[model samples]
Target: MFCLVLHSHLPWLANHGRWPVGEEWLYQSWAATYLPVTAVLRRLAAEGRTRLLTLGVTPVLAAQLDDPHCLNGMHHWLGNWQLRAHEAAGMPSASHRDLGAREHRASAAALDVFETRWRHGGSAVLRELIDAETIELLGGPLAHPFQPLLDPRLRAFSLSEGLADAEARWGHTPAGIWAPECGYTPGMEIGYAAAGVSHFMVDGPALRGDTTAGRPVWDSDVVAFGRDLEVSYRVWSPKTGYPGHAAYRDFHTYDHDTGLKPARVTGRTVPSEKKAPYDPELAAVAVDQHVADFVDTVRRRLRSESERIGGPALVVAAFDTELFGHWWHEGPQWLEQVLRALPEAGIEIGTLADARARGYVGAPVELQDSSWGSGKDWRVWAGDQVQDLVQLNAEVVQTALDTIDKDRDANHHGFEGDPELRKRVHDQMLRETLLTVSSDWAFMVSKDSAAGYARDRAHKHAHALREIADAVASGRDEVARRLADGWNAADGLFPALDARRLPVRSAETAAFAGSTQ
Candidate 1:
């Protein structure tokens, strides 16, 4: 069985900068990836495909997709895409005119779809597919924190809250999760069981590369599905992938005047100015060949893996949802064709939920510290270069936990204080703290991809958290309320989030956590 997983996620970028980094990241993914990807799923579902794949739209991304601010901003961004296309039409270069004509058509379709269907936000589209059983939706923590380094109490709280958030949007609480970075700790399955998560993803090496089927973690019913890198890398890999094909549009080569990508990836290391113009016909041909190649690769792997495992095998090829259309302009087309072609090639395709229900599961295994990042270990998040972020996360999380517990101990519901104000203070404090714990900050810093912005964002949220916590500690109730209210104006996404709901661990659990990392 072939189970494809697409994890859709982005850090909260609502009030962050626009160009060069923040909300621009969100808008670009929304327009270039989310819109087209969902459109493809809907088209396939219309053709009677059910349980085509497992889609994990992280809770943070889901919140933004449904937010009023993001919805309005997305509309404006689509309008801007059309304007840019029009400007490209008047450029003197024939390649510029061709690119303009193509983009104008694409942008026009995207804009109309945005206005008619997506104005309410992406939940409407995803919810429809979920209800139809077209795909299995997956959930993750509210802010996509690296669970391995997070405090156990906060970790459980994040997972439970994230599942609840998904239910609110999609009308289905996911039983599966695309664990942030596919990061795992030895004892995490206990938290997963508590949160009612039956399955989660892990790197292939975690299961000793015998990722033929989902393995139960330890003795619990919670299962960990490992990504089959052999098959997955055929499409996307660090060294090479179909995206680098010469016929595909070069993501980095752009019509600077119009901001449209107009060149093909003529050569891997070739400069953008020297690249050839993108040809849709050539791209279509490449897509066909790649699709055929991927289907054959999966078939061969399924046959070999099944024979090796002494039973039918499960091959899961997972990737970030943004890889489609956003990074590889032809990705959505490739995806649609692959889903169609796989079934015809005699390979059964289903969601992760289907694979589990069909008994494609193995005996319990003791998983270890792992992530799908570099080296397939915790170094990407906990490496030396990012030690400061690791320290910041540790300190802020501990402080937030201590402050919340102290508040409860002090007033037993804040009898001597404004109860509503106290709750708001703690809620916003936890919000800021959660934002700080996002894995993106350390990732950006380690990779030097907007390291400065990542640091500024991390510090900004850290400052908000400290300010809010301090006001309450100083008996400044009104000041605390204003501080939380102001922070909510920016970091607002999970509207129903409550600090009071955050899990309060017992002494035994806390001591265990202290003894570990």
Candidate 2:
């Protein structure tokens, strides 16, 4: 059986900004990726396909998708997309005008879909798929933090609360998770087991290069499935992938007038101005060829592994969900074709849950620290290039926890005056803390992809946390309440988040503390 996993995630960006950054990111992804992807899944479900694939929607992203603020913003963004497409049609360049017309129709269709269905929120759209059994939903930590770098207590709390959040939205708790960036450390299995997570994904190297089947981790029944990089990278890779095909629409080169992509990826070395105009017919042909090639690749891998293991083997190919319609315009179509073609090719399609339930298990193995990022290690997040951010994260988390612990202890004995106000402050502190620790900021800084923006976001959240903590500590009740209320209105994502889930200091440790002014 071949299990395809798509990890869907975006950092919490609600009310952060709009053009070229925050809300725009959410809307572009929604119009291009989520709407079309869900439409494909819905079509397949209507045709009675079950357990088609596994999708991981991080709690933070889920919250943003379901937020009324974001929903209204997305609606406006789609309307703008249609207006831009219409404007493009009047461009002097005939090629640009044709591309504009095509985009206009596409945007119009997407707008209609959003208006009729997604006007409510993404949760409603995803819940329909879950109810239809079209996809197995995988949940993750509250903010998609790098778990290996986090404090164990915070890690446990985030995982538990994240799972609960998923259950609250989807009616069913996920039995598995696409661990943030597939980052894992040796003892994380204990946390997974504690949180009732039976299965999770890891990079191929984490399993020491053997990814033919799911292996029990660290003597626990919790299963860790390794992605088959050989088959998976055929669709997307840094150097070469199907998306780089010459006939496909160029992602980087945009028509300056319309802000729409009108050129094809003529060649790796071709300059944007020199690139050829995109031809949808040619791109369609390429998608078909690529889909057939992917199906054959999976077939070969499964057959070879089955022969080597003396039985059927599992071939799991995973990728980011955004890659489909957002990064590569034809990717969603390619995916729909691949999913439908694989079944006719005699390949069994199922989710990770279905794969595990089918008894595709192996012996227990101790996994190494790994991530899906470059070097498959912790360098991307905790390396020297971003050492300052890493230290800031550690200090911020500790301070936030320490402040919460102090408040909880005082309130426990009725010493701290207003329990309700303290609780509100604590919840806002956690929200800021989680936002500060998000893996996106670290990753963007390290990769130099919007490094300044990433730094500002991290520092902004940390600053808010400090203000609230200091206000609460100084007995400035009105100041703390106002700050908390402001932040709750601005950076709010997880409405149901509870600060009590955070681990408190041990009694022995707390006894050594004295009241401070």
Q: Under the 3 Å rule for N, CA and C atoms, how many clashes does model 2 have?
A: 0
Model 2, residue 30: distance off in Å is 1.0
Best by lDDT: 1
Question: Which ten contiguous residues of candidate 1 have the minimum total lDDT?
Answer: 413-422
What's the TM-score of each model vs. the native? 0.97, 0.96
* Candidate 1 lDDT, 1-517, residue by residue in tens: 9999999999999979998998889998988899889899899989888999999999999988988998999898999999999999888988778989999999999998888889988889899999989999999998999999998888888888889998888878999999999999988999999889999999788889988899999989999999999999999998899999999999887777888898899998899989999999999999999999999999999999999978999999999999998899899999999999999999999988899999989988989889999999988899999999988888788778878888777768645655434377888888899999999999898889999999999999999989888887877889989999999998787877887778767996588556543
Predicted structure 2, TM vs. truth: 0.96
Model 2 ranges off by over 4 Å: 414-422, 506-517
Cα-lDDT of candidate 1: 0.90
